[model samples]
Target: MIRDDHQAGPTLTSPRSNGARISLAHGGGGQLTDELIGGLVLPRLGNGLLNELLDSAVLPLDAQHRLALTIDAYVVTPWRFAGGDIGRLAVSGTVNDLSVAGAKPLGLALSMILAEGLPQRDLDVVLASVAQASSEAGVPVVTGDTKVVGHGQADGIYLITAGVGVVPTDRRLHPDSIKAGDALIINGPIGEHGLTVMLAREMPEIDSVLRSDVAPLNHLINRVMTRHGGGVHFMRDATRSGLAGLAADLAKQSGRHITLDEAVIPVRPEARHAADMLGLDPLEVANEGKVVIVADRNQADQIVATMREHELGKQACVIGWVGDDGDGICELNTLIGGRRIIQKPYGEQLPRIC
Candidate 1:
């Protein structure tokens, strides 16, 4: 819990580079990761459009049209999982990135890097999943390239997918649009995707059943946008670094104090226990099939009700509210009525769990 009297300066929440060599944590999507982007990457390649740092970069096509572009790469160790495979992850990940930006996905470009000695049968399965997921999301695969690496030089397979979508003429969603007193909502439980992947790799001996919650969320997001429009100010898919990461980013971007009630957040019992056993915080894990939304306080209830009408949002609930904080902090109210600061993790709990 953050102390009520605690005051902070107007420091940017973005990451800063410290001249240290890159580590896996830099890509973990946490505090250090943000620093790498803000300090190093952005300095070298950033421009006005890139500086916004939204999941997808929104580009203006004309006065009435805007394009959203986002790209994601998949390198999950096993490639195949209980609920989905890398192919599915590639599609869902890219599609969700565009969707969360309030865009209607038009198509995707798939690129593949294959290692020598990779099995043809495995490639078939992965490509099939990709095709199916693309069709299911109604986003066609428009263009792609494939490359092969020498043996021992690459993982079995790696997938890079880029997507393009069209933002509605009337929609203007960004963290800048959020303010204090706004309500935060999450669709469905958290940690399933991270826990599922961890269990499959670290504790395969265990027999507990848990599957990754990997699905395309464009339709659900479109539904909310259609009704709420500007009322829904910000949206993010809680992927790497989980809900905590999203919360911290939002707080910093909005420059507001974001507080969450731990008791009200939904987490599957299995995920909770699994996280406990693994000595990890479910909030800091990853999620592939969940979304976090920030909407006007007056419209929060209606937004939740509308979310519930969708299968993907059946478990949606308001999790917290924004507060006046000059320092851009995120706080969590625990079960014992204690409040504490929710610091973003320095790195992800598990590597390559996405």
Candidate 2:
């Protein structure tokens, strides 16, 4: 545990950088990954409208205000991981992406790629899982396409999904508004999805049943938008590129810095132990069901309580706060009282773990 700085709020001590790189760890959905996206990728292609990091982008209309859109692909190895399958993953990934953008998912456009010799029953199982996940996620599969390849041409299966949602005029979200001194919150434990899939792929000898965190976070989004004034500054699913990569993106867009207390950062003991054995930092691991939010401290308590009201946020915490570091840097104030720059992840640590 880190010494409490809940009072002084640790000062930002990280060096600032603009370069960002993609790494295997970037795919883990932890802190390193967040930095990569936050620092590098988003600055080049996105604007304020694209920065909210919500499940889907919410557009305020002078008159038109009914549709939201997002597209995503899943090429996760071991198509069938502990918690979900490719089909379900494809659907939920798209749905959550749209959801985080401040949209309520309504329909999906799906596509699948398969290899020869793959069992039809396995495909059936995956499709069934997709249907079930869509139901649970409150979205529908409205259309799709499929393709097949020879035995060596494909890696079992790949899937892509496009989703559309409706945005209410009342809900307004933007990432640029993510000001200094804002509170940073996580909806649940981090790294579970990435680690679970890794456990299945690399260490099946370990008896623990790890599951993917591939569920839609729309309902949770609904609860938040309905309860709060939708004063949310930013929102993002901890996906390809972990929390670090995502935070880096936040820092870049808002033109400020973020200081996270290592102790307050939440990670399950099981995940921590597994990551230790694998020489992985839970911060850079991937997660599907989790989200990172930057909002006002006054609203942090209410947001956390609303999150806990849902099944996903029982471990929700105000892990850190946005600060006036002013150079787009993110720092981790160690439990031992040291501070370090959160560099972009380098090589692949857990490839295909997503």
Candidate 3:
């Protein structure tokens, strides 16, 4: 069951001051976003399930089954990008949230907010994309709602999706299960999705090969869980604030150090160049088609070999490992025999690239 009534009210405050206000950075999924959720949202509404703060909330439905639910809103500008649009993003994002939590997606509920001047052709195109993505993931859009707003009120279109899935009672995936000797593995390269969207929105004139890596990862994850369920301890998709953000959060939550090897982290040359040109760190860029997994050290090699057999996991490899020392610190071993600490980005670096 879900609750909409809470006695407490929202407590908003500027990141730098005592005054109450909201900033764009608050939605960037960085430090500000964390503060907003931890300080304000949690104080007013956090409960046993919500306090867990996993990608999706897992709830027991009966003696033999458990339910996982997740909701997300997409306000990505341009509505369309090189490899995907907002519709595909909404579906994939919601589905991935459930999958990482060890759930088999059941269905989705979609809600759309449309601007008055939005074109019907654009709406039809987006809906078609949504249907196609849902079919690819083997899930259905079971219900929906639509609302029209004044011209310019909505950014052409906005999508909100809620996904429900079933988790086997035996499956266990959470940060608390992570251990110092566990290995960190990622399915593929990072920075493609965020860089693609940024270039498409800002420098449409410059031709590049970058394309948003936006696709549902449920099948790929399901295969991994089937073979290595006993070894897998935790999983999280590197979204909004990117791989660095996710790694940092994992370290803090598990109370262990995370050390990443820069040489092994897969990054395409084109993506590296684009990031350097834009003065952005590729490690902090968002990705829609990637997930970070923590698994037993003994099973790491076999897991990578199995992952490489799938299309989505073609470049899968071990990028890091949990350490026995430090208090929630994440460090990167540089290619030049140097090291640096990784921190969650303080504020918005690349805005609206989600």
Candidate 4:
């Protein structure tokens, strides 16, 4: 467990451009990833809107509306996993990013990088999955590009998807709106996506029932926003670095302490077992279909109840709460009645899982 005094800071000690090269950990979406972005990427490219660092960039549109845009790349090694494929992952990931920003998705743009000698059948399957996921989310793929590279130059396939949505000027969700006593909730069980993919890739012989929880969350999020927009303060999808990453980030961004109750955090039995066997912390594992929400404390129960009505959020429950202002520390109340600080993982635990 990371100690509270273990402050997060720039991990790179050398000059920005001197003898530095990118590594897989830089894309792991953890502290090192943050350092890379904050230390290098932001300094060169950040603007007012980009500096906000929200999952989606909220841009001015007309007087009554704004635009939300997000893009993500899918490089899951197998490109296909239990319950979802790369195409589904690409579309769902993009759509969820928009939804957490309180936007209604308008359309998507997809680009594919294909390796030469890749089977045409595999491409067909991926495209079909993309179409089905798009239809399910009620979002259309408006435009796209495709390119082919030498057999060894690329993975079997790589998918990049960008999504655009419209948000009412008043509905922007941000950490600035969160306050002490706000309730933190999650939509369903965690760690399924990462665990499922890992098992499928590394331990396929194991007879496990784990499945990736990769699905578009626009409808479920829209439902909550429609009924409890006023109570909702902030929302984020727990993706690359999982729930712990998001919580740690929330504490830092909100400048408030956060407390999560371990007993109530939903982790399925199979996922927990797999995590233990693999020496992994479920809290730090990736999740594709989970969103951590901060809402008014008084309406936490109501929001959970509302979430339960949706298929995607049937296991929704309160997992934590925002505490008084502090140095942005997050603590977990363990199942054994112990308390420990929660910090973002320094690097990737499971790579190529998303």
Candidate 5:
């Protein structure tokens, strides 16, 4: 049975080990990522606003308003993928960051880094995707700049996107507000995007029709936040480190144990098969179009039903719940009736994975 009470319990082990030097795992959005940020980044550059590490920072714009600001850099290799291009990924990624923070995206600033000798046709395709994504998200790219670098100095194309969104005065979404007993919700299947990209590069011989699950989620998120408002405590877009990394980070930040059931967490059959073939855990792979919601159990049923009504959330499910078992630890209840710690990746599993 699910329990909703918050009580102090045993101290669970942290995801990070005593290590030095930055590695790809540090950027994989797991324990190592946390150590890099908490251990080094925070002590030096953290302020009241930056320390929280929310996808978007809520800045007080005036006595009556707050603005959410976030920025991201995209360097996905190949520039083009099965479901999206670099341009679309850049737009959708930034827009989702703002939306997850309970913001209504207003505008975006884009900057492009073009490598010398890159084909103009490739740039055109990426730009077209950016335009389509921006239009669909209802957030305009109001400003941008472009630069060219020496050949081989960079990938064919790189993009930097910064977004601004408005958060309603009455709503607040942050990990600090998440309490034990809140249900953990996932919008849809995980690992499709990461696996699709990996397969394109690593095992092109294994051909399948799988495509990246990359899309803008602002409309889907806006529905839930507007309807449930205060009942929704925290939300995050599962990106670089997939769901496993997200759970680990949430546990660490909220000082609560997040227990997930393997049987209930949704994964597409093809995605699971691909992950298995690669010796990867689907939960630890990356995603481009997924969101994790922490909300009151009382509101979870309604939330899941509402999510199903949206195309992006049609596969939404209640994956887990927060509890007071091991402080700042994340665990998974295995299908075989055992428990395992879900830790952040130590090094990059798939480099340039957006």
Candidate 6:
């Protein structure tokens, strides 16, 4: 649906929009494209850096320091769903990457690939949601581009966001810092975000109420960083591939095998119910606003406490520890006293997940 002004993404696809479905005109730089950007994109995402609208952004760089940058592309199916939509998911995904790396998010550059026959109103709604997410994250949409493809040349729409952030002072967080005794801490419940989309789209027959944990973790990260910056060995958000991949990466790269407690790992009741019905491994699903943190054993409790203070981290727990297995794999200690090897998922269980 089209509107004189841009509305949020979820609002765009509702029956009330003045325009139905999108068209090539929305991507053209003329009036329709102008409406798409001005009416929708700008209002939600515009800020000091973005409003400049120059070919490039000029900024002063700090001396003797490196910057952290991350880019994420959102192609989640059914763009709008329970909890969060693609627009907000894209923003949060990019920002969370920076946050887990001990960085303060600075700005985002958005690119939209529009399929022909898509509605102008739909573009407006999507852009507006992107804008709102960036605004909430305190990041500006500094620059962007739009391209239209042939009908069926693309899925409904695709969004790409590149983000930059500043790392903390005197922080040496890296996989190398993880020691054999460091505790593995998760910053929230395991499977909400992954199951939310799966159930929303009726994928894989997982049928309980669930939603994606798409949110900004900057504040939670900051709180934990404040108390344990030096003690933090590493941080990573579990996304398209969840904890197993993250755990395995830390295991191989840091030369520390990871051990996780099955019973202690947090999972929501809805997700648990759904997982039982579908015979799915929740660890294989995606999460937009969660992190796997490595902290010194002495500081693990403190880190968990700091995280729980933030709403995003209410279920934070130390579910594992660094161990000495040479295989560099993430091993789970099941509730039934059995051990299983956790590896990166072989293929896409759910595609189009940001």
The digit string of per-residue lDDT tens for model 2 on 1-354 reads 111221122122231453333456555444454455555545565465444444465555456465777887788888887788788778877888887767778899989898998999989998998899899887989999999999999899888899888776655556567787899999877888888888888888897745677787888878887787455776888776577767765665566788888888888888888888788888877788888878888899999999999987788889888887678778889989999877546546678864
Candidate 5: count of backbone clashes, pairs at least 3 residues apart or interchain? 6
lDDT of each: 0.86, 0.75, 0.90, 0.91, 0.86, 0.73
Q: Where does candidate 1 stray beyond 4 Å? A: 1-19
Q: Which one is best on lDDT? A: 4
Model 3 Cα lDDT, one tens digit per residue, 27-118 = 99888887788668788688878866778999989877799999999999878999999999999999999999999999999999999999
Give the alpha carbon lDDT tens digit for every residue of 1-354 in model 1. Answer: 222221222223343533367787777888777776766666678666666777898888877879999998888877887788899999999999999999999999999999999999999999999999998899999999999999999989999999999997778788777888899999899999888888888888878777899999998888888888778988999999999888987887777899999999999899999899888899999999999999999999988999999999999999999887756889999989999888779875778866
Error of 5 at 240 (Å): 1.2
Which parts of model 2 are misplaced by more than 4 Å? Answer: 1-66
lDDT of 5 by residue, 199-232 (tens): 8888888887778988999999999987887789
- Residue range 1-354, candidate 4, lDDT tens digits: 122222333546564758888889989999888888767766678667766677899889999999999999999978898899999999999999999999999999999999999999999999999999999999999999999999799999999999999999988588777899999999999999999999888888999988999999999999999999999999999998899999998888778899999999999999999999888999999999999999999999999999999999999999999988677889999999999999999988888987
* Poorest lDDT segment (10 consecutive residues) of candidate 4: 1-10
Candidate whose TM-score is highest: 4
Worst 10 residues of 6 by lDDT: 1-10
| Residue 227 displacement (Å), model 2 | 0.3
Task: Quote each prediction's TM-score.
Answer: 0.93, 0.84, 0.95, 0.96, 0.92, 0.79
Q: Order of all candidates by TM-score, from best down to worst?
A: 4, 3, 1, 5, 2, 6
Off by over 4 Å in 5: 1-23
Find the 10 residues in a row with the least total lDDT in model 3: 1-10
Cα lDDT for residue 99, candidate 5: 95
Number of clashing residue pairs in every model? 5, 37, 0, 0, 6, 12
Q: Which model is ahead, 1 or 3, in terms of TM-score?
A: 3
